[model samples]
Target: MSSQFTVEKTQHPKTKPDQQNLGFGKHFTDHMFLMNYTAGEGWHDARIVPYAPLSLDPAAMVFHYGQAVFEGLKAYKTEGGRVLLFRPDQNLERLNISNERLSIPQIDEALVLEGIKELVRTDADWIPTAEGTSLYIRPFIIATDAALGVHPSPQYLLIVILSPVGAYYPEGLKPVKINVESEYVRAVRGGTGVAKTAGNYAASLRAQEEAEKQGYAQVLWLDGVEKKYIEEVGSMNVFFKINGEVVTPALNGSILSGVTRRSIIQILQDKEIPVVERRISIEELYEASVNGTLEEAFGTGTAAVISPIGELNWEDKQITINKGEIGQVSQELYDTLTGIQNGKVKDTFGWTFEV
Candidate 1:
């Protein structure tokens, strides 16, 4: 795993964006890290080069077979001039899981982590300093084989890029309206849903677009088989506070295992709050709303630490959560998570990795 990395600085550096209006994934830093994987050579030629368009063969396997995987995390610049990463190890572990599922060669976890740290340090100035702003890190692998056969690619390319991003949603922490999607299913049991691959997201674009058209922020996906049980939100894991108990869907191989979701569960358990991970049906959620037991709802992910779900529209029926405002539980969780990330509060869970 010990490999020498060559660094090449960009000749024409771009101007940094305004921190206040730094939208997500719109702009990338000057340099990116890349490594290649071949059948017998394994992974080699690790280097940091100027960010630019990639020249790939048109017959690359990724275009046809969709053998690719990616992971998203962030680097934060604290008020005290310190840089930090939140639960990066977990993200890499999950990336390997995705690689295994996609039949892509496994990455050296430690080496890749070192590459990420080096890349972040190399572009330290790119980390945003404004409130709710951070450097979004995207690490991905793609099959680069030229042949069109339906087998695993013998070649691959791993790339890590950095983007200075603002809030994931333009509304920031404001509560959002979600539409329960019953028509199109995102994933099914024994499928690629659990993997953070391109195909899974490609399958969701239609549903997400329809949800957006209906004046909703995101789609609340249901299980594919029954279309009755709740799975996850379009881009995050969902949680509902029902009758003082917080419930989220159990990991049943069809939902992405989110790092933020795991952290929130741990945080709740540490505080001794009633948290349960089990299958919850959409009908049960609607019934809880009718009985006035659905206290609050929120979605957890890396992009939006916690997105408070204020309203849900399901089959022409609308249910308002917490009077269409941010609830106390959601607020506390958001504050604690963001505070730990930005160095405003003590990180008791040892989740922050200081770079």
Candidate 2:
């Protein structure tokens, strides 16, 4: 919400080795963007300060209540060296939705765009020109008011940080095995699951660790009440191919409405694929898999645009999908999505925002 910003320049004094193969969210850029928000003053004191530690009170509300929300996106450099952003407006809109749900004051769309542009332009050189690498941008707001109560904090801090990230899967897109957890739930009805808040991810750590120990890439979270309907997988939204239709879980107040998921649905519908957005039960998926109706399964998100789900391990049963490889439709979807993102194909939907 802060419109006034004092621009400053800083540098990363020490550099690491040529770690070209570094995975996502590992390295940081030179500077960061920060802005403060108070109850009566709204947002103010915006600055592009050095990327360093934050001085917070021991009794900060965020430390106790976890009143924080964040969004993730990327800045890509095109073939002609023209940097661009894919559907940044969509990300900004989603950030506001997250903020409102978390009791934080909504940010002005224009200011948010300007702040993002300023940060990306300041760190433009950090945008990796390599094939699967780009500048990963993380914008977040946290409750900073020194309060011990279990309520929303009146003061908050909004900041954006950049990171040079390699391809999510450096070895090319590979199918991942997922384990469905029937014990723990990622989201519940009327909860903060839809918001990109810190608590949701924190609650998923135990399940993720358990999945990893079981030789699964991520946990396929089911609905909280019944634990029968499919919600999402890890942090990504899940998709399924049943019969000849491409279907995903309907945005029913529990799962995150990912920008990548919306883009894929639009592309599918544009190409005349029978794309359906509805509640999909785990039993239906298992039945479809057994009857050869479920052809493929995958997850969609910003980090990995579309990741194939090779196998779904539930209970003691293992169901292999698309023969442990990327399916026909999944490959096409990935190609079209990434092509539009990298400026290789025509962006009919006007999703690419050239910088």
Q: In lDDT terms, how accurate is model 2?
A: 0.88
lDDT of 2 by residue, 1-355 (tens): 2345677777444374254775788888778989899889898887887788999999998889999999998888888888788888988898899999999999887787778888788778788877877788899999998979888899999999988888888888899999999999998979998899999999999999999998999999999999999999999999999999999999998999999999999999999999999999888988888998989999999999899999999888888898899998998999998888887778899998876
Which portions of model 1 show Cα errors greater than 4 Å? 1-3, 169-171
Poorest lDDT segment (10 consecutive residues) of candidate 2: 10-19
Clashing pairs in 2: none
Off by over 4 Å in 2: 1-4, 11-19
Estimate the TM-score of every prediction: 0.98, 0.97
lDDT scores of the candidates, listed in order: 0.93, 0.88
Q: Which candidate number would show the highest lDDT if scored against the true structure? A: 1
